[model samples]
Target: MIPGMGAVATTFVAGVEAVRKGFATPIGSLTQMGTVRLGRRTESRAPKVNEFVPLAGLNDLVFTGWDIFEDDMYAAASNAGVLERALLDQVKPFLSSIQPRKAVFDHNYVKRLDGPNVKKGKNKMDLVEQVRQDIRDFKKSSGASRLVMIWCGSTETFIEQGPAHQSVKAFEKALTQNDESIAPSMIYAYASLSEGVPFGNGAPNLTVDVPAMHELSRRNEAPICGKDFKTGQTLIKTILAPGFKARLLGLSGWYSTNILGNRDGEVLDDPGSFKTKEESKLGVLEHILQPRLYPELYGNIFHKVRINYYPPRG
Candidate 1:
């Protein structure tokens, strides 16, 4: 299951269906296309990763997600325009069969976006309970023994780990009191972890990066990961920065700018949401370059990231 069935989520669902139907190849999917070397190099024992490790096949996957917008997966995929119409049409029936559930959303957290399809609750804890119920219903209906939740959601307003995030007890109390510190992403994470479902965060929100979440994950034996999906600019930086550092290259400044018109672009147009993304992007270089280790080469460097929302590009 997923939260925020937007461009990323729809593309994923449609792409998987397309691949399963043999319309296209899973080119960038490591699990589908990658190989792992075993034993000695001379053994020539390289096998596909999926063969080496147990994993679900494309046909075994099922799709469901929550969206503040009321569009079904087909409509959402078309609106995204990430995939060609011809490809989407081939998978239209399959995509159309999937519809998003009402999402847990708040205008305060995602300032630039709002939609009619949203969950209503008396407090944050009530929202959590509602989400938990959604999980149970999906599990029963889908007949899937194990489940995972990937947060393909929008970037929320910048927030820090606070007193409410220090422990599960504190978080529960804060949720009951409708604390402003608890963002929508956190609510989903809390619900998923509580249900013992693995949760993967695909946006730069302080979702599972807290002590309370850590404790919950351990107690429930549910896996949780991420603050961002390094698919674009950050992916490039992670690749190139390490090479630059290995070669002992020096950098004085690095500036990155992007102009996008998708829903993500519009959402990031809000400064609060942009700040969260900025923090995730800016940390990449400092981490790979090891500024503390190579003070002379990296310490004084300036880094700037700017994102401009251009609807015309869409």
Candidate 2:
């Protein structure tokens, strides 16, 4: 299951369907085309990753997610403009049949986005329960034997770990009281972990990173990890920064800017939302370069990231 069925999520689901039907290829997904080596290079034991591991095949996947908009996947994909209409048309019935459930959303966390299809609860804990019920219902209705929840939600306003996030006990209390520090992403993460489902965060939000969430993950035996999906600019940074470090190249400044026009871009137009994404992007160079150890090359290097929302570009 997923949250925020916008461009990224819709494109992914539609592409998977297209690939499953042999109309297109899973170009960017490693699970489809990647290989793994079982032993030494001399052994020549490499096999397709899916074959090497007992991973689920494309036919087993049942796509479902929560979206702020009521549009079905086909309409959402069309609005996204990321895939060709002809291709989407081929899978229209499949896409159209998958409608999004109501989302757990708050205008405060993401100031620029809102929709009528949102869950309403008396408090935070109630919201969590609703989401958990959604998971259960989806499993029963879809006949999914196993499940994972991948958060492709918007970037929430930047928030530091506070008293409410210190422990599972405190988090529960805060949830009962509807603490202001608890964001929607946290609620979703909590709900997924509560259901013993592995949680994967694809956006730059403090969802599964807090101590409380960690405790829940451990207690529930749910695998959880992520602050962001390493795509777009970050993917390039990881590839090139290692090369620069290996060559010991001196860097004065690095400036990165993105022009995105999707729903994500609109949410990030808010300063509060952008702050969360900014920190996620800014940390890449520092961690990659290890400026404290290599002071001469990376220390005091000016790094800036800017995201401009230009809807026409989408």
Measured by lDDT, the strongest candidate is 1
Off by over 4 Å in 1: 312-314
Off by over 4 Å in 2: none
Highest TM-score scorer: 1
Query: Predicted candidate 2: what Cα RMSD to the true structure?
Result: 1.0
lDDT of 2 by residue, 1-314 (tens): 99989898988899989998999988977877898987899998888888888999999999899988899999998999999889999999999998999999999899998899999999999999999999999999999999999998889998988999999999999999999999999999999999999999999898888899999999999999887886888888999999999999979899988888888889889999999999999999999999999998899899999999998543
Q: Which residue pairs show collisions in model 2?
A: none
lDDT of 1 by residue, 1-314 (tens): 99988889999998899999999999899999999999999999999999989898777888789999999999988888889999999999999998989999999999999999999999999999999999999999998878999999999999998999999999999999999999999999999999999999999899999999999999999999987997877988988899999999999999888877778999999999999999999999998999999999998999999999988433
TM-score to true structure, per model: 0.98, 0.98
lDDT score of model 1?
Answer: 0.93
